[model samples]
Target: MIRKRKHVISIGISATFLGIFFFFITLNNVHTDTYDIARFSTAGETIRSPITIENEQETERKTRETVQSVPDRFNISTEITQERVNYIEEVFDAIATLESEELGEKENEDDKETNGDRLVPLSNQEKVNRLKQILSEPITESLENETLIQLIISPQDDREAGRKLFVENLETVLNNGVRTENIQSAISEINQSIKYATLNEELKQPLTELSKFAVVENSFFDVEQTQEARKEAASNVDPVVIRAGEVIVQEGQTITNEIYEELNLVGLLDGQRNFFPAIGLALLIFLICSMIGYELYLLMKENKLEKGKLISIIGISILIISVLKLVSLFLTSENQIFYIVPIATGAFLLKLLINERVAIIFTALFSIISGIIFNGEIAGSLNIEAVIYFFFSQLAALTFLTNVKDRTSILKSGFGVMVVNIITILLFVFLTFEKYDLIDLLIQTSFGIISAFLSVVLTIGLLPFFETVLGVLTDIKLLQLSNPNQPLLKKLLTETPGTYHHSVMVANISETACEAVGANGLLARVGAYYHDIGKTVRPQYFIENQMSNRNPHDFIDPKESAKIIISHPYDGAKQLKKYKLPKEIIDIAEQHHGTSLLKFFYYKEKEKEKEREEVGQIDESIFRYPGPKPQTKEAAIICICDSVEAAVRSLNEPTEDKIEEIVAAIINDRMTDGQLDESPLTLKELKIINRTICGTLKGIFHSRIQYPLKEAK
Candidate 1:
C-alpha cells in the first residue's frame, strides 16, 4: 500500500512537471515577434501595446538644446596691425624721392635701349596707380591729387612713432570689429582719428587708410559659447514624458513613421523579446499547478481517487491544452476570433470521466491559459473574447452533461453548450461595442457552433480509450457487463439456470440497497450478475442448479461435501480472472461470501463424528471459503443482499417484518463473522444498508393474496 501510494504521488509530481514543461514550451512559442512590416497601419484595426515604452530619444533631443550664451572669441594680430603703418610710411618716402632719382638718371644708355618700356617720367596720377597696384587695398583710383602729393612727402617714417600714433587713435577707433556692413563705419572711425592726429597733412590721409587696414574683425563665433547656450536651452526645456497607458496611436488613424517608431519603442512591434511576460506566465503556471495540486490532495483525503484515474485526468488536460495550442498557431492579433477553440471538450470529458466540480475549476484555469495562448497580437495580453466564450461554454457543458447516459443526452448537452457559446460570443461582442459586419458575425457564430460539436466529438472519440487504457469502470461499461448475453452470464444461465435466476434477484436487491447507502449501485448490480459463476462448473453439486431431491452430498463424506462447498468461491474468482473481468467483479465473486463457513456440510461432519461417538473440534478452515474479506462497501452490501434474498425465498409467507428480521440477521452475521471489517463502512452506514436491504427484500417477497381453489383444467 505504501509503495502504491508513493508511486501515485510520483506520477502526480511527474504530471505537474510535464504540465509545466508544455506550458513553458507553448509560452515561448506564443511570444511570436509581431510582424516586422513597418508599414502605415490604418485605424480600423485594433492595436495593443505589447511592451512598456518610454521617451528616451525625445527626452534626449529636448534636453540637449537649452544652452546659454557666452562671449565671442577674438583674434587680434598686433604685429600685422603694426606692419600696416610701416608699409604706408615706406610708400610715402619712396614717392618723395621719385622726382630727384628720375632727374639724376638723365636718359642713360640702358634707359635709351629700354625707352619703349621705362623712359617716361610719369605724372603723379600715374605714380598713384603704381602705388595702388603695390597695395591691393586702402588705395583706390578716386583719391585726390593733393592727397596723392601729400602721400608722397609724409614723414611718419619712424616705425615706433608711426605705429604708436596709429595704435592710440586711428587703429583703436577702427578695431571695434570690422565686418562687411561695418567696414565703412570702421573707415569713418579711422578718418576721425586721422583728423585729430599730430601728423603732417600729407601723412594724415595715407595714415588713415593704413589704420583702416589695421582693423579686422576682433569678435568671432565661439563654439564653446554656442554649445553652452544650446545646453542651457535643452536643460530649460521639459522632458517628453510617456505614461504607461499613453496611446501611441489611435484606431482608424494612419500609422506614420513616428508612431511606428513609438510602437517599436513600446515593444508592440516585432522589435525584441521581453522577459517580464515570460516571468508572469511562469507565475501563472505555478498558481495553476498549485490549485490543481490542492484539489488532488482533497480528492486523495476523501479516498475517492486512484493513481490511474489521476493520470487519466492529466492525460485529458494535456490533450485539451494541446488542442488549444494547435488552435493558437493560426492566430494573430488582428484575428481575435480565438473563441472558436473547443475548450468545453475538456470540461465535458472531465465531468463525465472523473467529475464535474474538478472540471469546473479546470474550466476556469483552461480558459485563462487559452486566453493567453490565443491572445496572439498582444503577446502575453489576455484575449477577453476567448476567456468569456471558453469560461461560459465550458461551464454550460459541465452543467448540462451530468448523468448523460445516452447518445440523445450527449447530443442535447452538446447543442446546449453550443448555444451558450454563441450567446457568450454575441454578448462579448456587444460588451466590446465594436462594429462588426454581418459576414464577420456569421463566421464567428458558425465557428462557435462548430467548436461545441467538435468538443462533443472529441469526448466521444476519447471515451473508449480512457475506459480501456485506465481500466475505468464507467456506468456504460458496468451496464454492458450486466447484459444477459455476456459469455460468462450465458454459460452460467445454460449450465446453472436456477443459480442464474437467484443471481438476478440478488442484482435487483443489491443495486437498490447499494444506491440507498451511497455505494456504486451499477457496480453492485454488475458484480451480482457474475458472482456465482463457479456453480456452472459443477451444476449438480450446488443446490440452486440441482433439479432432483436427492443430494450429491448424501453419498460423499461430510468433509468432502464441505470442501466442495468451500471451493466454489475460489473457483468463481479463478473463472472471472480467466475471463479478464474487471477487478471489482472478480473481487465480488471472491469476497461476497467472505470467510463464511459451509455450516450445513460442516454440521453434517459433526453429526457423523457424534454417530461414531468420536466427535471432536472440527477445523473451521476446512469448512470456510478462502477469503481476504469484503474490501469495499459494494462487496459487503452484496454479501448481505445475497443472504437476505435467499432467506426471504425460503419463508412460507414472507412479510415486511420477516424480511427485516432476515436482513438484520444477515448483516449481523456478516459483521460478527468479520466479513465487512475491511470495508470502510461505518456503523451508521451499516444500519442504513440493513434498512435498505430489508425494504427491497420485502417488496420482492411480499405476501400474495390467497384465492379460492379452482379445478385444474
Candidate 2:
C-alpha cells in the first residue's frame, strides 16, 4: 500500500510538472493581443489576423445581390390553353343549338311553308338576344351583339364555315401562350388570320371580332417558383472568409472601417478576450499529460519506473518544451526556423537513459506540441508540415539508433535524422509546387543539417550529466565500466588472477543464459566480472587460486573457513558501493551467493561433531551465506551459473553427461532450497536458461580426439 501510494504520488508530480510546463510554454502562442486604435485611424504597424473567420456581413450582401439578380419565374400553365379552346368550342356549339331550335320552331308553325310564312323568320336582333340568353354569361359578354347577329343571318353552310374558320384561328392563337403583356398581339394575329379567310364581309367582321373573345392570357407569375429560384441562388453564394495571418491593415496606411471590422472579426480589436484558445490549449495539455500518466503507471506496474528514470523523463520533457517556447518566440510565418530545434536530442537521451517506449511516447507528444508551436503565429491552427517533419525526424533517430552501444552510435543516428529532415523539407517544398530559388533551398536544407548536429552535440554533452547526477545506468555507462582498466576490475585481475579467470567463465555463461531468458545480457556479464571480487581480499584461501595443489583451507578450522567464505559477497558489495557503481551492479555483487548452505564446510564440521559424538550441536545457520536473495532474472541466473562453473571445474575429465548432471543438480538445489523464490524467473524461463547454459558450457569444454603417435616422425 505504501509503495502504491508512492507510485501514485510520483505519477501526479510528473504529470503536474509536464502540464505546467506545456501550458506556460504554449500560452503566449494561443493568446491574442487587443488593439486600442479605432476605425479610420492611421495605422501604427502592420496588423495580421489572429484567427480565421467568415465575414458574415459581406457574405450576406453577396447573397442578397445574388438572390435579387435571379429573374422572377413565370409558369406557362398548359391548362389555360385548353380552357380558352373550350370557350371557343362553347360559342360554336351554342350557335348550332340556337339554329336547330329556331328551325324546329319554324317547322312547328307550319309543316311546309314559303320563306315569308316562316313565322316572320326571326330577325337578326331578336336572334342575337335569344343567343345571348342561351349562351353562358362570359361568352355572351365577350362577343359583341353585331357579331352574333351576323352569325344568325348567314346561310347555314356559310355560318358553319365561318364558325369552323373562327374556331381554328382562335385555337391556334390561344395555344401559343399569351401573357398580360402579349395578349393584344395574340388577338391581332387571330383577327388577321380570320380576315384573310374566304368568307363574306359580314361573316369576316363577326369572325374578326370573335378572335378577341378566344385569346386571353395563358401564362402567369408563380410566387413559389420565383422564391425557390431566389433561394437556390442564395445557397450558391460562397461565404467570404478572412484567413488567419492575413494582413488586416498595412503599416503607415489608414485603418479603414473595413479593415477595422476585419480586425475586430479576428479578435484583434479592443474588449475582445477569447479564452477559447487558452481552454483548447489546456485540454490538449491535459490529454498529453493523461497519456504520459498512463504510460508511467504501466511502467510502474512492470517495475521499470525507478526514481532516476522518472526524473530523467520529466527533466528531458521540460527542457525540450522550454527550448521550443524560446524558439517560437522569434518564429514567423515566413521563416522556417523550427527545423533547427534539435528535437531528436530528447529522443536520444530518453532512449539511452530509459527505454524506447518512453522515448517514442515523448517524441509523439512533442511532435503534437510542435504543430501548435510552429503554427506560423496562427492560433487555433495546426501546422501539419511541422508535425510531419518532427515525427519523421525523431522516428528516423529511433530507427537508426538500434544499438546504443556507445556515443559513436548516437552520432551516426544523428546523421540519419539529418538526412530524413532534409528529405522531409524537400517533400514539403515539392508538394507545394512553389518555385524556390537555389539559395532558398540550400538555406532550408542547412537548417536540417544544423538541427542534426545540434542534437548530437546536446545528447553527447548531457549524457554524462544525467548518468552522474541522476545515477541512471545506461548501456554506455555499463560499457565504460566493462573496460578492463577500471580500478575495481584491475584489483580483481592482479590479486586474484585464477578467480578472475573463473569469473570470466562465469560472465560468459551468465550473459548467454540471461540473454536467452530475455534479461540484460551486458549487465549480467558486467555483474559476473565483479561477483567474486571479495575473493581478492584473500585470494589464496579460495581453491582456484591455490595453484600448487596445497590446500589453504586444510590449515584453518572448518567453522572459521565458513565465516571467511560467507564474507566475500558482502565485502564485494561494500567495495562496489564505495566505488559508487550503479545499484544493479551492487545488487549482483551482493546477491550472487544467496542464503544457501555451504554443504562441504557444514559436513566437515558435522564430521568433527560426530567424532566427538555431538553431531546435533553443529548449527546449520552458521554454515550458510547471509543473503537478501537474487531479486532479478540476471542476478538469479548468475547465482546458479557461479556454482555450476566452480562445480564443473572440479571434475578430472569432464564429459557432456557430467557437465549436464552438475548443472541440473545445482539448479535443482537452488529451486528446492527456495533460493530463486524471490527472483522473477518462471519455470519456463529457467528451462531456457538451462538449455542455454548447457550449450555454452559444451562449446567451452568440448573434447579433442586423441591420435596414436609413432616414433617422432
Candidate 3:
C-alpha cells in the first residue's frame, strides 16, 4: 500500500512537471516570417543561420506604422468639371453679343449715313480679328491657331447650334473625369462625340476643336492628404505576426541572405524544435534524478530514508527549477545577465531541510538546469561559468549550514554565500581578461552577490511554510518547541511542577546522549520536555508530585496504581496529538518507556496475592506499560535519559562512579527488556550514550564545599 501510494504521488507530481516543461519549451520556440515573397530557398534545401537573431520589435513597429499610413482614395470632383463648362459657355456668349452688335450696326449704317456722327461699326473680318485678340492670351496658352479661332468666332448660320454642340461635346469629354495619364483618351472621346453630333461641317469642326480644350486633369493627387489617409488605414492594421513552426524558407525554394537571417533570428534555421534543446532538457532531468536517486540510495543504506523527506526534496527541486524557467521568459538582449535568478536558493532550502551533501547535489542541479534555461541568451545552457559561480556559492552556503540550529544561522549562511559569490564573480571577470567593460563587470558581479542575498531572504520567508505544511521538524522548529513559553510546556510546569522539573533534567540528559550518537539532540531535548505532559492530569498521584507525607498510592489498590502509572505515556501522546505537536515529540511521549513493567506496583500486588492466599501468579503482562518500543534513535535516547536522570537524582550523594554505575545499569536494564532492540542505535552508540549521560549527571550532582548558613540577613 505504501509503495502504491508513492507511485500515485509520483504520477501526480510528474504530470505537473510535464506541464511546466511544456510552458518552458514553448515560450522560446518562436517561428516568425514564413512567407515566401521572392523566389527564395528551395523546398528541399536545409536552411542555415547566418547570424544570431532576436525579435525585431523595431521593425515590427515600422511595418505597423507604414500600414497605418495608407491614404484614402479620391475620385475627380464633378464641381470642377461643371465650372469649366459654364466658363466655356460664357466665352461663346461674348462672341455672340459682339456678332449681334456688329450686324445691328450694319443695318443701321444706311439710316446713320445722313447723320454721319454715328460710331463706326467693324466689318465681319475686323470683328473676327477683334474677337481673336480678346481671347488670345488665355487661348494661346492652351491651344494653337485653329482651336483658338473656333473659341473666338462661331459660324454665322450655325452659331447657336455650334455653341450647343460645343457644350454637349465638352460634357462628354469631362463626364469620365480625366487625369494626366488618360487626358489623351478624354480628347479622343471628345472628338468622337463632336463628329457624331448633328451640325454643319463648319460648326462641327469648331465644336471638335472646343472638345480638345474642354478636358483637363481634375483629380490631382494630394501627397500630404494621401499620406494622412494611409496612416489612418495603417493604424487599424494588426501586426503581421508569424507563429512558431512556420516554414520560413519552403523546401525547394532558393534561400536568400535575408531569409537566412530571419530564420536565424527565431532559432528556426535548422528545423522545428531543435534536438539539442530536447537533449539538454532530458540530460538535466536524468542528471537530477540520478544524483538524487544516488543520495536516497545512500540514505537507504543507513536506514535513514523517509518518504516525506524524499517528497520534500523533489518538491523543492521542482519549485526552484520552475522559478528559474519563469525568470528566463523575461530575459532579453538588454538583460542577458540572469543574475536576478537566485541560484543559491535551492541550495539554502535543501541545506535547511536535508543536509549539506544533498544541498551540494541541489547546487549542481540548479546551476546546470539554470544554464540550460539560459543557453541561448547567455553563453550556453550548461555553461561552465554558471556551474562555477553556482558551485562556489552553494558550497559556501553548505559550509555555513554544517550544523545549522536556528534562523539566525541561515542569515549567517547567506553572508557566506554572498562572500563566495563575490569572489567567484571577480575570478570570472579576471579570467575573461577584461573583455567586458568595467561598468558591466561591476554590475554583473553586484547582481551575483544580490542573488546570494535574495536567495537567503527567500529561504527565510519560505522556511515556515515548508515546516508547517510538510510537518518537517527542522532544528529551528525543535528550538521553538523547546521554549518555556510553549503552551504544553507551560501547562506541565504549572500543573505538575515536580514532573516539569524531572522533564527538564531528562531534556539535558537526552540532548547530551543524542549529540554523542550523531542523532537530533534538539529533537530529543524538546521531546523529553513534552513527554510527561500526562502527569499534569493527576500530578499528586505520581510519586514525584506527592509532596505530602501521605501517598495517594496508599489509598488505591496496587493494580489501580500500576494502571495510573502506565497510562501516563499513552495519555500524554493523546494530549500532544490534540495540541498538534510534532510527531517526534508525541512519539517520545508514546514510546519513551516502551512496555517496561511497573515492578514496584507488580511486586506490591504479589504481596497482596499472598495475603489473600491466591494460588494463581499475578500476571506480569498486566502490570507492564503498553508496548511499542522506541522507534527512533532520538526516542530511545530520551527513554534512556528519562530513566537515568530519575535514578541518579535519587542518589544520596552522587559521585562520578555512582553516576557511571547508574547510567550503565539503566541502559543494561533497557537492553535486557528488549526496549532498545527495535531502535536504530547499536551497542557501540549506546556505550557512547552511556558515557555522555554519566558525564552530564556527574556535573549536575557534583560535590560542592559545605558552608555554614547565616542566622539572618
For each candidate, the alpha-carbon lDDT, in order, equals: 0.73, 0.87, 0.73
Per-residue lDDT tens digits of candidate 1, residues 99-159?
4464566556356767655455667777666666654354444345555555554443633
**Candidate 2 residues 1-713, lDDT tens each?**
69779998999988988899889878777887778987788999988887888999989989999999998887776787777777767777788898889879977778556544545677778888887887888888788887787777777788778877777776676665678999889888878877687877777877777777777888789999999999999999989999888888889999888888788778887544668888899999999999999989988876667888899989999898888877877787677888888999999999999889988999999999999888875788888888898899888889999889788999999989999999999999999977999999999999999999999999999999998888898999999989999999999889988999999999999999988987889999999999999888888889888888689779889999999999999888888988988888898988998899999999998788888887366788899988979988889999999999999888888899998898899999999999999888999998898888889999988998899888885
* Stretches > 4 Å off in candidate 1: 1-4, 7-11, 29-49, 52-279, 301-303, 377-380, 615-617, 711-713
TM, every model: 0.66, 0.76, 0.63
lDDT of 2 at 14: 89
lDDT score of residue 549 within candidate 3: 50
User: Which 10-residue window of candidate 1 scores lowest in summed lDDT?
Assistant: 65-74
Better of 1 and 2 by TM-score: 2
lDDT of 1: 0.73
**What residue runs in model 3 are displaced by over 4 Å at the alpha carbon?**
1-284, 300-304, 377-381, 401-403, 433-442, 708-713
Model 2 lDDT, residue 523, Cα = 91
Candidate order (TM-score): 2, 1, 3
Can you write out model 3's per-residue Cα lDDT over 1-713, one digit (the tens) per residue? 47545654554455456435533553343222223333353556544332244446645677666765564445677897887787677667768777777778877886787787566756555655666666545553555556545544556657777777667767766776678888888878877866877667666776666666667887767667777777676666555444432345655777676665566555554454355545555555655655666676665545445555666776787677777777767866455466666867777788777777878876876676666565443212244665667667777887876556778878888888888887887787678654788898779778877888888888898888777777766778888888899899899988888999999999988988888989888888899999999888878888788877579899999998888888999889899989888777888899999989888999999898898999796789889988789988998999888888888878888888888888888899999999998888998999899888878887888889999998995
